[model samples]
Target: MIEASLPALNRRRFLWGAGAGAVTAAALLPGAARADGHAETVGAVMDGMVRDHNFQGVVALGRGGRIRTARAVGMAQIAQGIPMRTDTPLGIASISKRLTAVAVMRLVEQGALSLDARITTWLPDYRADVGARLTLRRLLSNSSGAPNPFRAAVAAEPALLQPPWIDTGEAVRRFATGDLVFEPGARFDYVLSNWILVLAIIETVTGQPYREAMRALVLDPLRMRHTTPVAPSEAMSYRTVSPPVEWINPRPPFLAAAGGYYSTAADLLRFAHGVYDTDFLSPTSRTALTTVEVASDSYALGGRMRTVAIGGAEVRAAWETGNTNGYRSVLGHRLDGRGAVVILNNNAISQRTMDAFAEALLRADAGVA
Candidate 1:
């Protein structure tokens, strides 16, 4: 859902100062600036985003289980005048998939499930004949033929584009009747429907909602106090709470496994630390999280496995991105967690800015020109 009324953004200004180069890493302290004077380059770019664009959020960098820099910029709500802080909660869209994946994997680690098992083994009534033929890995890897549930939800509930909210059950019920776009595992097509089905399976197996399972398996143990599956009662940003004209508020079931998780910069850093430390999954499981099982170049079980180079530095980057209506986010870490960046914006801001910031961090980590 998108508000058609908001003024068109200044594309040039939105991306000003963000370019591909060997800029300083935000993970470094201010004093850590290189003698060549590129160390504080990240801070300058972040400062520019706030001072120039209407960017509002926090940016945190963590390495080796230590938070090197965690700073907030702009206001949480432009009208209410609330300042963004480390603990300021933000809707981290599809990034939520990683959390959901981790929860499901925990069940797998417990011998409660297998990634390759057919969905029919768990939910016999799951619609799509192709789904019965699909395995959990295919779903996680975006190879499942499921179409995005959101598209179907919007088409069915035409009023969903506006504010207020809708019931979660309606979304689920509507989805239960849909069919897959193709036979499972035959090809990779990124679809939110894959995760919604995953959530259904989790509920069928655990006898609890997907949110409850995640809180139990991932959030609690990691002490991610600021992270949860709870939907907000009000808009957290100055931006319109929901899409305009349609005026539909965010509702549960609609959020399911595809989206609907929330967290703060502080909490996300903690999650990064936990993953690097293997606090939630075993060493083998941790390896699986980063290991590339598929060749899509954008997704994995619970995170995205990709690579990017900044200057002369080339590193394997595991990441996930999410957006819903007014939210946009990027969360990913380097292989060693030596460099990780979490950027969340309320509106459809430029992801290129986030990517440029990440490139800068990789440059600093590699200590290259």
Candidate 2:
């Protein structure tokens, strides 16, 4: 239910950092909030996991409101031999969706738009008719019926990996004026165009570009210093990097509102804390962020998940996945905020493994593991 084609990014030179880890028994456990508790064991466990998967990147664990453990495995820039570290920046693909959703909700809170109102009321430049009836709610919940934008772009332009000289603008254009595969609120298609449009709404109502508005509304508020949108000219794109094992080259800026943000595991944990704690939005907006507006097994605002297997058991948890360029990430937290996990990878091999890790953490917190 979660498969999608990835975009291309030119493999370039990169930098790396030292690795560290935290063990289950370390003093750095979430309860202690001490950075010293589990660093060694966590580093070893994560490094072993990375080697086992033949994946390169960094992994960090944040629990009890502090970064208890962080480790970078493999070289960040193979050419330069840079090791991964807790502060190493990595692209977080779809995880960007949650931030975008938060930006849109901020607008909703400001009365710039209504979730139930037709999006056409906000975006008059688009060419779709059903769009006139599509609501911000439908788009946020994946109920908007636009088909996947990359497929159409690939259909028109074969080499989508290169510079946007042709493919980039065309892809955004096809989506900007594309047909709706299903009426708003009919069924779930998990297309990439929905949040792109939501971004347009944020820009329209707030009179700021999506990147700037996102920074102001989400990142800045959460103090996510390492997180930023992927722009075409960003130096990170040219930094030689490893390939993601599961998925590859999920474009950053091209898929901006849907996917396309970078951050460290520490940064993501802070973002999760803000989401669960509502440090950025009001009480009403916070309720709206987690409200299950759609019927999918997993998918909310920018995150996706209904249930997860943890500690040899199924647990209810909300989560998000990201894959782009040479980076991948996972962010999940229990609704109660007692448990949350962030895994950022330079390759795609960590999704399932991170899920297992998250489950274990949940079990430990739930006293079931």
Candidate 3:
């Protein structure tokens, strides 16, 4: 449930370099008194969520590089009675897209890829007509007209949801290749095929498997030691909190670049710091990452960038959310250096409530009324 006191954010503007883009690491860190207050605010809201929604996972609020509040509520594996911990890794779902986008940008910075070039430059095997029209920027921004065939197919044949592992090339050919649902870059559609094709491009460009390329480009550099493309033995998702019926959501190798990965709250926070607080990305790439390309979706490259008004103060941030099976996650990183909010859950709850919770934490951390 959402906090009644916290006002819903009004996303009125898309401001780049207004928050995280201009701030230094030293300025983003909070003082001791502020950190204490932030912890109190987070704890109170988290306690309420656990009591009301049966939230089962970890929630962490951090500023600069230090964690102000990190709590684990409910159980990771209900059948085994394994309690959740702040370090417990949980499936991050589409948050993996943000990581994949970053990896692709790194390649662009290295002169290995171009954002405006037609996808066919790298994916010659793709359908010529469609590939010639789609570009890396359009795909990253979810403006690629790629149709979501997997969704319909999975609904008709549940078995198709998680088949045996397939290589990136095969996955792209079977699932990603499709007719354009709309003119490329004419509108927005959050299709999984875009990232699937992106995975194939990454593999072809780097001459490495998706996981290996991700490790070399992103995970290893960020020191996200606990994050992995392969699903780890961590939390077990539940459809219901009282009886805790298991929800099976498998992550095959081909889906790694889309919505397939497990991560801890701490590791996710580390990623926020690496991306926003440090010089991990080049200036051009960093700017490109947060520049709003799709205004209707509030999307930049792989994530949403918008201005949130909290307590009469407008805060610019990168808001990334994921929900699949019974797992849900949110990563809110304030570009203004106030901090970040990371929530990972095993039991499916209202996404609106989760988003509100994260925003409330941000408001409290910023001490905005």
Candidate 4:
């Protein structure tokens, strides 16, 4: 069900940190006098979501390098009665694409890979004609024109969802080799094959597995200790809230880079600080990572650059969302480094709803009515 919209505020009245009226109102709210109102506002929205949408997961709000709200509601594993916790790792789905993009940019910064170079430079074993035509930038921006065979194959045969585990190179050779659906870089065509080929390139350039390279390049440095490419055994997803029926989503190992990592809301907030608030990435790489490569999709290298209305002010933010199986997540942070909202849920929720909830949280955090 779609949530009712939050009360509208004047865009010109409330700037991020400069609004006197907002600060005074935040100081007047009960239990928000000491805090930045992030805790109070985020908690209220989360409580409503849990009651209305059966949201079962963790949420963390961050500002000025500190976590203001980190809360978990409902159950992580309903059958076992395992309650959700702020640290509980849940599948982040396509948000992994953002992480993968960061890893690729790190390589670019190190001179290990070039965005404009043909993918064949690293993946010589790939199909000559196709690889020669594709580049790292095209693949990262989802304009490679590579077709997604897994989606069709899984739809036709559900059993294929649990395909045998294959190494990155073998998986790329088998599934990523295909005729271009459109001219490379002419337009955006978001498909899993682009990320699959990206993983192969990372492997070739780094001489390490995708998971290890990512841990070294992004996760470890960001102190995201709870994040992992491998899904946890105890984490169970749900399709509905009324009856709480289980939804078993199988993720083959080869597709980890595309959408198969488990993370906590706190860890994701940590990622936001590292990527947006710190100098973890070089200036050149950071600019490329956030620059919108496709205007139609608002897609940059790994995530989307979005302009959202917050407290009447037009705010540019880095927005990344993931929805696969019964899991859904959102990581939205302002480009100005004022604040961020991270929501991770195991019970299936529509991406549109999740995006709205995240935005509402951001608005409330800023003390906009």
- State, as a TM-score between 0 and 1, how close model 1 is to the true structure: 0.79
When summed lDDT is taken over every stretch of 10 residues in candidate 3, the lowest stretch is 9-18
User: What TM-score, computed on C-alpha atoms, does each candidate reach?
Assistant: 0.79, 0.78, 0.88, 0.88
Model 4, runs deviating above 4 Å: 1-32, 36-39, 155-160
lDDT of 2 by residue, 1-369 (tens): 001111122232211223343323344454444333333334434444544555455555555445654544455544354555557777777888888888887878888889888777877656657667777878888888865666667678666655543332344566645667877777876777776677777877888767788888888878887787653122232223344222335353546787777777777888877777656777877777776767654566667764756557565666888765556677877666666777776644556776665555445444443
lDDT of 3 by residue, 82-167 (tens): 76776778988889999999999999999999999999999887899999999999999999988778777668866655666666
Query: What overall lDDT goes with each candidate model?
Result: 0.64, 0.63, 0.79, 0.79
Indicate the worst ten consecutive residues by lDDT in candidate 1. Answer: 14-23
Q: Write the per-residue lDDT of candidate 1 for residues 207-256, one digit (tens) a residue.
A: 87667777888889888877766654333643442232212226455455
Clashes found in each candidate (C-alpha, N, C closer than 3 A): 9, 28, 4, 1
RMSD of each: 7.2, 7.4, 7.8, 7.5
The reply for model 2, stretches above 4 Å from the true place, is: 1-48, 158-173, 231-254, 308-315, 364-369
Q: Which ten residues in a row have the lowest lDDT in candidate 4?
A: 12-21
True-vs-predicted CA distance for residue 277, candidate 4, Å: 1.6
Whose TM-score is higher: candidate 2's or candidate 4's?
4
Q: Which stretches of candidate 1 lie over 4 Å from their true place?
A: 1-39, 51-53, 147-150, 159-173, 176-178, 231-235, 238-249, 364-369
Error of 3 at 91 (Å): 1.0
What lDDT score is found at residue 117 in candidate 4? Answer: 95
Query: Any residue pairs clashing in model 4, and if so which?
Result: 11-312
